[model samples]
Target: MTNWDDFRLVLALARTGAIRQAGAALGVNHATVSRRLADLTRRMGGAVFERISGRYQVTAVGAPVLEAAIRMEAACLEGERRLRAVSPDMAGPVTVSLPDAIARVVLLEELTAFAQANPDISLTLKCSYAYADLDRSDADIVIRGASAPDEHLVGRRLFPYALAHYCARDYFDQVALPDRRWLVRRTPAQWIERSPCPEAPVGYVIDDIDMLHEAAARGQGMIRGACYIAESDERLIRIPGSKVEPWEDLWVLTHPDLRDAPRIKAVMGLVTEALMRSRALIERGETDRCRG
Candidate 1:
């Protein structure tokens, strides 16, 4: 009988083609990878790798073994997801990944409420710009802005997201836009060309939306951000004549294999309900200060 673990190591080595790289990817040492490969080759009675141009290449005999190993890995992962989905108890960790801005301003309270309601379930709120890999169990759920979702994953479209220009109450002045300093995310060019205050001078280039909002509130300069956050903030005032900057559709995504998990379902239900209830605020930027 062939050991699946040995085959997994072989597959990784074949995929990476370097002992150091494969070891790093598999969280093992280079010596371990070499030792394991030697043992695997001896057990199989054939060389699985061949040196080609000073790089390791899978041998003819190893190709089929690698393919089988990949299939086995997929099957095992799917089985785990399915088993987790069918768990009768609602006790486990559910990691939810989303943009830092949304997590801080919009989802924070709702997430807190959900956590309080479900003490048995542990929740990890990952705030990041990088997309989490649902297929590999990087996260159990994800809230993201996307125009199109992967066909393999199951997702629910939440609502449309939009951005607008805003400034602190004291920062607003009826002057040439070029004179005012701009608080931007990446660079001023992308926002300025499309913004109402196109020529606003660049001052601060911040990556984090929450920090940008704070700076704008302190009268640093005008800032651009999601309408839901800017409108709700009392310290910031929306710029007059600013147009809605529609980005992408917000979505709640999960792996197809774990879509039926009770914990995932409960979290998804609460999150969906919360977002649905705040649709007007999130989509239309409905706020008492819209006129201000």
Candidate 2:
């Protein structure tokens, strides 16, 4: 019988098509992967993969084995998720995945408080723009900005993600009308319809929101960003005639299987409440100074 670990090696190799990449995925070195493949070949009495143009391709004989491996892997992951779902104890790790901007500007303080309050539960945050796979257990909780979340997940839509144009106070005052520019993440066509200064030429095309915010703060040019982020920055001020545009809704999500777990429930509650508390600011950038 093939060891499950060896099967995993095969699966990894099949997925990545390179010994080095497969090793990296399995937390082993390329030599270990190669040796394991060699050993598997000896035991199976045939080659599982063929090298074709510098990439590993599964052989016809290996196809059935790969299919079985995939089934086994899925069953293992499901079993693990089921076990976690029924765990009554609140004293294990819970991972939350969210975008870096939201993690930094919005939920940092609240999440910190949650950590202090729940010392027994280890909290891990995966901050990125990429979505983590809930079905694969990549994250226990996810806070995302989307028009509609995956229907399989269980969670609440917190509020509309609002955005508006802003720039450094000094830049707003000092830059002449024609000289002023817009700092954007993409082509102006994407946001020009919503911009107060549609005529302003694009000054800088920055893809990272954090970098764009910094540039705007440094008086480089105007930027359109999340209200919750830019409105809180004292260095930046909204453009005089800018209107808040509603984009996708912000959602807090978790897999249905894990939703009932004690620790998952607790964390989800905390996050939902924290986000809801800021609904006004999130949905419309409402503030005393910004009130129409």
Candidate 3:
């Protein structure tokens, strides 16, 4: 009989197409992944994956196995969800996934208070740009910025998310309009064309939002960022002519199957209430100090 554990290896390897990546996803070492793949291949009496150039490609023999693994994985996730749905205990670990920026700027204080108030419920935060697979139980709760959430997820649209152009206060005062540039997350041309300063040069292209903000704060260039984050920073100030751009709605979501669990419900309620209380700041980027 094929071990379900081996099938998990197969799924990971097939999805990632590299031993190292698969191991990283599975939280195991590359050597362990290799050894397990070798053992599984021996049992199957043939190779499952063949390296073509640099990547592992699924062999003809492995295609059906991959399909079966996918089905089994779905069934396992469904069973887990069903079990959680009926769980009565409110005291246990609940993981919330969200972007690092949101955790830092908006929700951290509220989440900290939640942790303090509920010592019985252990809170785990997975902060990343990558969306967690709630259906797969990657997270019990998810806070995300999205145009619209998936049909499988249940959550509230907290507020409209917005971004605005900002630069270091000193930079804004000292830099000549012709000399200023943009620190951006995308290609220079893309940002420059859309920006108010179309003729401005690109100072830096950074993938991380926090790093981009830092660059802007250091007077490297102006940056377009979520209004709440940029406005909260004392080092930064809004560009003179730039306007806030409405992007998407901020959502707090969870899989329907797990939504009814006592801990999940409690966390969701608290988080939703907290976010709603800050809806004006999230939507318009106006804090008490900023308004003053």
- Please write out the lDDT profile of model 3 over residues 89-199, one tens digit for every residue: 778779999888778876899889989988988899999989899988989999888886898799787778788888888985689888888887888356556777778
Q: What are the lDDT figures for the candidates, one per model?
A: 0.82, 0.88, 0.85
Q: Residues 129-218, candidate 1, lDDT per residue (tens digit)?
A: 788988778889999888888878896998898888888876666434556888888853576777767766788689887889889888
On TM-score, who's better, 1 or 2?
2
- For residue 188, model 1's alpha carbon misses the true position, in angstroms, by 7.9
Shift in Å, residue 180, candidate 1: 3.0
**In candidate 2, which residue pairs clash?**
none
On residues 75-164, what C-alpha lDDT tens digit does candidate 2 reach at each position? 988888888788788878899999887888778999999899889899999998788899899999999999877899998887788999
Residue 288 of candidate 1: its Cα lDDT? 56
Q: Give TM per candidate.
A: 0.80, 0.88, 0.88
Going through the candidates in order, what is the number of backbone clashes in each? 0, 0, 0
Taking all chains together, the TM-score of candidate 1 against the true structure is 0.80
lDDT of 3 at 131: 84
* Off by more than 4 A, model 3: 19-47, 189-191, 290-292
